[model samples]
Target: MEVLGRDRGSVMSVAASGISATSFASINAAGKVTLWDVRLQHKDCMSVTTDINMLSGAEATDLLLAADMHVAVALAGGAIIAYDLRQQGVLSVYNHTCDNEAFLAGTHPPAEQTTLIADENGAIMPFDLKQCRPTAHLSDRFFGTSTTISATSFGALSNICCGLGFIRPEGEKPLLCAMGMDGSGALYTDPQLTPSGFSLLQESDLVEASGKVLNPPLPISASFLEGYVAIGRANGMYSIAVPVANSTLFEVLAAPGHACNGLSVLEWTRGDRPRLLTCSVCGVVSLWDVMPLVLETPEGDEVIDEDLPSLDVAESVRDAVGQQVSVNCGAVIGDNLLVVGDAMGFITSCLLV
Candidate 1:
């Protein structure tokens, strides 16, 4: 994808979603956010003239996709700002500690009018999106490192070293799964978020491994399923059906050496199975054989389920775009389409077919 921005700085974050049959929003690194109509076939996307200088000497590190594609930018100076794309309004610019020591690491709860932001201080601050003010903040006893969604369910993962995946059922309060990031990949069931006993994603009646723990294998990305959770780990990609029954939760479909630094998972099969697209640091791109994931207990993890049928590889789409660059962030646009942002400041879009 070709990105046009007024700021000379590289794009820190980008989000694109089908707003309608004709319009989409593309926010760039310079913080110059714009909406485009591919149907009009215009050379440049429609620009929303703003008096507020978003990219003017502003340093934003990340962007979140919120309701109506509301763009929230995490500033380098440990503050957060949410902007509405459709309407020309500044939703809120969060005011917190101004100390240069603390940085805004990440933000979550993208859909809610209120969202949570992870700070360098290892705290998750819940902010009201409408007011752009902080309501409450909580600490997870660890640094706010990385977060992701489960393709099947609305659940999400907050992986702090050995971490917790938060799941809230309809009309029910959120539940926390005490998972470890030990190099070994699996979902563990610990009723409590504190350090305690937990169960791993295994098949035996004695599924919980006592001394064995989860070690951070590689960079991990997550997606949800109807009742299960799929994780894209660094060594390979695995899926775990939560609420462990007699079945194996973690299935290592792809093995080690498959760099999953930049992995993107989405609601695939028209909401049936979860689709997985991964771009590695080495510049290799691969697709997983995940169809609406269906796993049975005791049968062990199978590669070809009714949902996940096969693995596909489209070797380094980044390489095809001329010279290869180190990729850090990427997002899925509709189906069979991907846009990647690299350290070199290149935003390349590709048809995944």
Candidate 2:
């Protein structure tokens, strides 16, 4: 859990509240989840906080917020719980007893109403918010195991050294992404749709991208936007790629010596371009101008063909930053506000600039 303070109260994960600019949620190493309102509060992040304990009684590994303000908490024992922030009560409790390792869960920005949870061993469980539980129609190996579906180079990879996300481009259906430490990632797409979201998995195709760059081969984080997915590395660099199933292409965004533990993307407006917000192991927050790396034309509709030849590319980087503190994970409240927490159990907030 990256317990720098060797305690359960140490922050393990943080999630942004898309509904509010100054509000967010997080879970500590001790499995305690808290709602945060830092609008005009202290920089320490403790300016205003409310602890929400669901009685899972274990360390929570990761968390994310839904548009309805439902906070999804992924715990260590394979059980994931969701809470309704509006009522400050439990929404449902789900148990995945297959893998004992800490699980990771996330929300796709394009489809924030939906969430996906994956175990270190590589089983993905999609949460059907309508049913208030993992989908019952899908088989256990429906998506195939991440380690074997389309994988190679086992010796150099750690199954838990992973990241998962999904992207919904302007005119395309949403696509789910699962990544492992070997630098190989797979994409699963289902054209059919449902009210609860992509529930029918009649048959899915696995697109494997061999394009990889793992500096230290350690655990990493993922954040997605439009058609691109950024993979944060252990040695302080991130790889931006098309995320198509082919051999794939890569654009490395470097932050020398600054181990990246977290990443978030915010799309641009008419006056400015898109940006990638990154938080590091040492609690430093930085911004990378991302418009140039994207394949989209200025019109923002047409994109480069995903069937492009495999190649590694580098682009000129324009970056910005803010004050530093000891950080474990964080969430972007709105366009510019940032809220983060560390293993010492201290919550903090800062501006991207």
Residue 80 in model 1: lDDT: 61
lDDT (Cα) of model 1: 0.43
At residue 65, candidate 2 shows an lDDT of 62
lDDT for each residue of candidate 1 in 62-93, tens digit (9 for 90 to 100): 55545354544334444566666566555566
Runs off by more than 4 Å, candidate 2: 1-8, 40-57, 67-72, 84-91, 100-113, 136-158, 169-173, 191-219, 244-272, 293-326
Worst 10 residues of 2 by lDDT: 194-203
lDDT of 2 at 197: 18
Q: What lDDT, from 0 to 1, does candidate 2 have?
A: 0.48
Instruction: Give the Cα error of residue 138 in candidate 2, in Å.
Output: 10
Question: Which ranges in model 1 have alpha carbons more than 4 Å from their true place?
Answer: 1-8, 16-30, 34-59, 67-77, 84-91, 97-112, 136-216, 235-270, 291-309, 313-315
